[model samples]
Target: MKYSLLILTLLLTFSMANAQKIYSVDYENQADVKVFVVDYANQADLKVFKVKYQNQAGKNNGKWFFTKYANQAEKKIFFVKYQNQADLKIFFVDYKNQAGWQKNFKKSLLY
Candidate 1:
């Protein structure tokens, strides 16, 4: 039981560390991930939830906090003009309950 618990904890820690890093780029060409903000959740590939604290940021689960500077961010994202031009498309949900990735294939774009 102790070994299982240890493995679970390690998995959680590794996943968290692999996630929780995001940056916004000034230009789309410079970004490692190109994203688009959809007007509605139904139109989005991912539903995002912006958290108040940086530590709260998680995987494709959408707990994000926009940092004041790019240097403080973990993953740099560029906003694309069109959804077709984006590597991942997202929508900001009003509530945390609405957050998650619709297309799991694009989930790696954030990490």
Candidate 2:
């Protein structure tokens, strides 16, 4: 009975390890404007897009939206509408992988 319990515990632990989430972040700068791209796990049905922005009090805010990516007649990409400010910064958040949100920009970008 003790050995059976041990085997069951090991099986649960292995299953939990394999079920992990993955996320990626990309940035682009053109003509003094910066854009951030966040890509998560791609399945057959849906995709997630997120945009992060910094408010006047130096706090970060984010919004998430989803759209169909496969087998659709029209392809759409969501964009954020914010005032044109040279001081805005971007970051990404990944909760499923046990990774905390991180700033994607350098210190110099804040200025």
Candidate 3:
């Protein structure tokens, strides 16, 4: 039973590690989510934390790791010229603990 539990835990962790990889696109029209980088954390609908490892990234809690290729990304994001045109507005928080969705309604955009 202990070995079975360990196997299950490892499988879950491995699957999660490959999830939530993001790609930034040059054009807003090509994006799954049109995003705006807010100047202040208070101005954001989400507070993002850029994780160094892909295993550390998660859904809607603002943990992101950018991938170099679009094919490798689970989410493709484009930066909008205006905040009003954005589907999601985010601020890059300095601390990992500060990362999360400020607006619950916008959570679906990331997931």
Candidate 4:
């Protein structure tokens, strides 16, 4: 029973490691992912929803929690002015259900 509990703890830790906890860095050089906000949903690689809590964040599925600290985030991103300079393109959606990948090929950038 003790060993099972330990395994569960380990599994949870590894699972949370990929949680969409994001930190926006001031500098592009400090970013793990360079992102661009697209004007239209069809132009985006991912349709994102901003979750209110860390627990509400998705597993690289576009539901992100913007962390107050960089250390708390799984991935740090910088917003680029142009789409050409971005590693990923995203469009913010009003509803949580609207959040998801439009083009999954760029999904590994967050992972």
Compare the candidates by TM-score and give the number of the best one. 4
Return the clash pairs for model 2, or none. none
The stretch of ten residues in a row with the least summed lDDT in candidate 3 is 12-21
lDDT string for model 4 (40-74, tens) is: 99999999999887767889899999999999888
lDDT of each: 0.79, 0.30, 0.86, 0.92
Give me the runs in candidate 2 sitting further than 4 Å from their true place.
Answer: 22-111
User: Native-vs-model 2 lDDT?
Assistant: 0.30
lDDT of 1 by residue, 1-111 (tens): 999999999987775574566778898766788888988788888898888776577765887877778876777889888888887888998888888988788777765
- Give per-model CA RMSD: 5.1, 15.9, 3.4, 2.6
- Evaluated at residue 9, the lDDT of candidate 1 is 96
Residue 108 of model 1 has an lDDT of: 72
> TM per model?
0.75, 0.22, 0.83, 0.85
Model 4 regions more than 4 Å off: 1-18
Output the lDDT of residue 19, model 3. 59
- Model 3 clashing-pair count: 0
Residue pair clashes in candidate 4: none
How many angstroms is residue 77 displaced in model 3 relative to the true structure, after the best TM-score fit? 0.4
Best by lDDT: 4
* Candidate 2 positional error at 83, Å: 16
lDDT of 3 by residue, 6-93 (tens): 9999988786765578999998777899999989988899999999877788765788989899987888999987999989999998
